[model samples]
Target: MIESSHTSPSAGWAARRLAELHLAAVFLTRLPLPHLRPPLPALSAALWAFPLVGAGIGLAGGAVLMLASAVGLPGPLAAGLALLATVLLTGALHEDGLADIADGFGGGATRARKLEILRDSRVGSYGVVALLLVVGLRWQALASLAANPLSAALVLTAAHALARASVPWAMVLGRPARSDGLGAAAGEASLVIALITLAVGMVVAVGLVPALALPMAGLMLTITAGIGWVATRQIGGYTGDVLGAIVLLSETAALMAATR
Candidate 1:
């Protein structure tokens, strides 16, 4: 019986919301689902449900790492397993985005060319470097926080929520690079969804550390705005890869900031 202003109540809100959640899963991960044409509606809803998706990822990662530790896995090994679990769960979708973006920006001479480069499947040197740095940073961060798994889990939760929240703001402020693409679908993401995402992010932050919630919120806002600015200037708009890059960068930045 839950109703969201953005979607119809009479259209079986529960079913629609569940569908949206499922769509979010599909967008973020490699979860199997029936194919559908015109994935915009589902993708849009997925953007809104990003925080929940992140929570699920956090729970899965925490559980795996804890289980590994319980079985006498070393802290470093447990952390590695948890990281691998996250990559596998998400199907490395964001990682692919990050790599493509790196290749595009590094190789292209013009904006259009950059976009074209991003669409290419082949990875370049810049992409390889970017992947290494991102993965290495994340692994190191988790390892540093290994002594406190609860805090590590909270960090992951906050990072995922805040990272996804950046996409809506980017869409709102940036132009679409093309007449049609993932960015266009993302641009169609509603304000209600954005608000929902922000609310969820705040809730996760506050739940993690009551005293640090305000600071974390401020950090999240600042990082999101910064990334949005970069997306606008560099690409002259947003794209799926751009959104993915935002998620990866924002999450890394938030974790780094939180640690300090």
Candidate 2:
């Protein structure tokens, strides 16, 4: 009998990709999966799976929205619950980053000072205001879409996937601002990985909201590029906080575009 071992390489590749995706999910969300070694290289290497993980988060949140709405809850309340679901799903990981970036960039006078503020555990007035405004915008957008729960779910799912894709594009935007930490450890994704991330995100987003894809694309590109530019100018390069802010900002913008 022939060993028929020709399938080994492709099988192995699939296994590795699955493991990488699992790793990406663990890093991006508070999902309960078996523990695996989180080597920094592996985290950055798994950037290609960012959209997949994000889609899962969005789906979970959207399901909550649909369920709440189906139960006869008010649109505002259902939308609020949906937003809460995603926030708790990701353990507020990106929200913390957004706050930190806001506090750091708005409060610090020098580059070193800005970096110091970013590392602080305490939130400032700037952080508070940033969170309120951004999260409020998200709530309002979700409420508007809640009129049609199915449509809201689709838009939310796409927004999550597309926003995450922005993170990888940023990897190639500028060098890391610090010598250590998640940002530097993440480093820059290779062009292939970055492009694949973008492609997957676009495919998921467009497939979900075909008619709104054009507007989502334009808005996402503008916000992502604008955030990347601001991050580079303010701190010399991307940090974890900056990337987190980008995801939230881009996601909100996409949702708004879909609602519009």
Candidate 3:
């Protein structure tokens, strides 16, 4: 779920879109786009650009992997560098979300307690274990793809793009868990925005690696659907942490699928 958005019709179409992309870049990354003057697009309106953000992230990480490999780094080390680049770029936004969700869901005994735990900034044993498992899985999968630069780039790019497309869908999975959190703050995104985002992700991912189109799409959809379903069952709806978990898990699965 996109956490913040603001838009005004006063801005021209091109400028509005640029601003929207800028907004997405800022929220989803550590990019230095700063404040959009005025006449900014709403947070929900900028949701469609989430895939672009993912593509950029994937490309950035893939580039580092390729470059590091070119400089004689081992595939495993190159993959680690690539993952580090992404973590630095995004400030581990999704990873942090994943950890929070794991800790909250695994430790909390009740819905209210779960929400409270999600809000806590501290990491628990559950969060640490979950992060270790998912991050380890991602690192190993990426290392496997590092044998070919082209394949590495395509898979990484597709994985990130398709993974982020799940955001809007995750947002729409159900009502917000908290009236004051990400779910409620993101508001109700239109079906159109969600479809456009999905379309962009499909085009980018399939275009990058046409051979794995079905697998990529299938794993992404499956992981996201499963995560969203679990979120709904656990807390009646999706939370910010739940959405983050969706992004990381989906991305991890996509990267794994790419290995095929």
State every prediction's TM-score relative to the real structure. Answer: 0.86, 0.95, 0.94
Question: For residues 1-260, could you state the per-residue lDDT of candidate 2 as single tens digits?
Answer: 87875668879688778888988988999978898754423677889899989999999989999999999998899999999999999999999999999999999999999999999989999999999999999999999999999999999999999889888777776678899988988756887888898889889987999887767767777787898899888999889998898899989999988776
Candidate 3 per-residue lDDT over residues 41-110, each given as its tens digit:
7778898899899999999999999999899999999999999999998999999999999988899999
Candidate 1 clashing pairs, residues 3+ apart or interchain: none
Native-referenced Cα lDDT, model 1: 0.74
- How many clashes does each candidate structure show, in the order listed? 0, 0, 9
Against the true structure, whose lDDT is highest? 2
Q: Rank candidates by lDDT, best first.
A: 2, 3, 1
**Model 1 lDDT tens row, 1-260:** 98757755767677667777777777777667776444335566667677778767766777777777778877677778887888898888889889998998888888889989989989999999999999888777766766677677677666666666766766665667777778775547667877777787778767766665666556656765676677667778778887788788777776666666
* Candidate 3 stretches greater than 4 Å from native: 1-11
The CA lDDT at 218 in model 3 is: 80
- Model 2 residue runs over 4 Å out of place are 1-7, 37-41
Which of the two candidates, 2 or 3, achieves a greater lDDT against the reference?
2
Worst 10 residues of 3 by lDDT: 3-12
Name the regions of candidate 1 deviating beyond 4 angstroms.
1-11, 33-42
